[model samples]
Target: MAYDLAPASVMFADVADVESAEMEIVHWDGGISIVPSGPVITRDADGGELHRLP
Candidate 1:
């Protein structure tokens, strides 16, 4: 016999939004897993904060 291992659902969003706004993770079976660190904020061409993965 074989078993299936996969998350019930997946989601994504901007780190800033997730931090500044309301965020939720709903899973049917398996639990949710979040990265320890969030996206990094760096200066853009115009010197604005840019959110991106590390």
Candidate 2:
């Protein structure tokens, strides 16, 4: 039997994104080269948001 990976990939990617914390920069790393991190949202490949996690 073969495993379907598309779903798994999406799950793992979201987990990584949230756990990665997108991190916080300190004085030693301060700058405007940052992307703010927030609540995780699951979406379809069409770019339509499906759910925003609480």
Candidate 3:
């Protein structure tokens, strides 16, 4: 399962639009990492094939 990462208080002042967001599945050590291209609120788990946002 994946956990949510809260946004840092000190964010960019000149906030721009989000280009895109995606999830990545790492192969090494059988671990999973969620990488976001922009400022998002959620991520996906490693075991699942699809990502479901609430």
**Candidate 2 C-alpha error for residue 46, in Å:** 0.3
lDDT of each: 0.39, 0.37, 0.34
Writing each residue's lDDT as its tens digit, candidate 1 over 1-54 gives 112225543333345545554433333354443332545333334555533444
Off by over 4 Å in 2: 1-38
Instruction: Please tell me which model should have the higher lDDT, number 1 or number 3.
Output: 1
Mark the 10 consecutive residues where model 3 has the least summed lDDT: 8-17
Q: What's the TM-score of every candidate structure?
A: 0.22, 0.32, 0.23
Clash-forming residue pairs, model 3: none
Model 2 — TM-score against the truth?
Answer: 0.32
Tens digits of per-residue lDDT, candidate 3, 7-37, equal 4311111112444544443333333344544
**For candidate 2, which ten residues in a row score worst on lDDT?**
25-34
After superposition, which runs of candidate 3 have C-alpha atoms over 4 Å from their true positions? 1-23, 27-30, 43-54
